[model samples]
Target: MAEEPAAPTGARSPSTRGTRRRGSARHRSYLRPEQPSGSPATSRAARRSARAGRRRRYAMEALAAFAGLLALVAFVGWWSEPARQEPPQPGGLPAVVGRPSLPGPVPTALAVPGLRPRERPPSPSPSAGPPSPAPVAVPTTLTVSQADIPDTVHLTETGRRDWMHWGLGGAGGTVRKRDGTGELRDLGGRGDRSGWDGNQELFRWRDGAPVKSVEATAEGVYVCGTGNGFQLAVAADGQPRTATVYLGVWMARGRLDLRSSDGGPSRTVRLEERHTSRSAQVTIRFQAPEGTRLLLSWTVEETFTPHCGNVGLQAVALR
Candidate 1:
């Protein structure tokens, strides 16, 4: 063909066509398989990895937006809420909700049963003088009667004879006597003396033993020995007169009688020996008119022996 395109310099000739074509065709096929496709031929594993990455990014962005919304809500609540206040303490002024305070002291009256409202007593007049003094009391005089004498008297016997001893032994025994001027003297062997000026005498029997007798002037008289008898006449003086007679006797066999000298009712007391050394006391009480006298008489009988018997008499007057 006009030298037909003069058969390009690098063109394959027909004679080597088979080998070159084969070689070149093999190379092109290998390179075509290695080149990227138009739409990528994704593998199953890579597609799954790409979808998971997109889901993770979306979750992160949504969480950040939720956190920002919570922060905004917290700020708005804090700015709108009211402030808090503390409660009042004890003994302090009470806090008022919406009111005023009460004033004044509390009243303390209580109702009582069966009691009327009390009225105050009237005050004394200003012109009234001081109250008069109360009157003093005077005690009245008291009079005693024979009934005041005690019904019982207690006494014990002293074995010694020094209290009063009568003259016995005929002439050598003790003699006790009171003269008209009230002077008493023991004139026998004993030589005793006293200044008692009253009429009294101690007598003795012919057998020399002292005999019992009434010594009218002595304050007290003692008698002893069995088969003895004596009488006493006592005078009373002063107005509203009363007298008490005391008789102390050995409780052997004896009888005692008391009667008014003017023949008033008589009272008698009797006793018999009991073989024991026991004593008795007798008290007599009676009213005696002024200038009157009382008669007391006693007798002792023979009973248990050593022939023991004893007695004493005393008279007292009250006005």
Candidate 2:
């Protein structure tokens, strides 16, 4: 018998294929996420599972991207921040967390060291401008006066640059200050002198040269007649100094002249006793630059008697 050919499985007969399929057949299976349209039918659960898996994968990818973005942001902030280091401390003190280091101090201007010594001050030339004014006040000043001899002349033993006691030996003999600065000087005299041990007033000293201590002494040197005297000087050291001259006149007139070497004021004092012996003191105060001097002259101005009328110098205390 010529029977009709059997239709293949999953395929409809020619007459049934012409129109749309009925019932469950009309509902085709949902597409897989990776499959194209019109593919063979697959299980619904399998397609649904594939779609859910795709969704979960996409979510995971998004979450990973967000995590990467957060990491990048943290890196940028860390790079922009400043680096800090705290000094190490002993005894296990806690370190400061976020304190930044401070900058060093800045210099105001650049300068060369040790340039002042060779620099010379500007001054006007003699012809360029009127002469500069003389110093308003001299660096040194001096004053001299005569007075009656005091009964007790207190000798300054300490606190002196130098001290001297002259005529302690004899004529052409002298004594200087011990451990002194060598400032008191005898610059020689104008005439001959003789030793005399008959002076009225006596000198007492606790500090001496060779003779460290002496209660009282009345030995001296004398120069007779006018135009003859003792010339002395004291070196200046920028400090006030005093030279006390204990002198006597036997029937003679004495003149004391004192001046500063630096053009300071000069003073002269005179004392006279025509017939009897008279004693006096000449105190001189002066100041000058170091290495300069205070010039002093003690002379006999006139004589009452021609035999031995003279100026007698007992002792000189320089303190």
Clash counts for the predictions, in order: 8, 0
lDDT for each of the candidates? 0.43, 0.74
By summed lDDT, the worst window of 10 consecutive residues in model 1 runs over 153-162
For each candidate in turn, the TM-score is 0.28, 0.54
Model 2: residues >4 Å from true position, as ranges? 1-138, 152-159
Over 1-319, each residue of candidate 1 has an lDDT whose tens digit, in order, gives 3554577779888868988888999989888855344445556557889989989999999999999899768656654554343356578966544232232266233324444423334544567678888654322222222222233211111111112232233222333221111111221211121222121322121211133333222234445566565565545332232333333445456666667655555677765545643234344445544445556565565445564454433332221
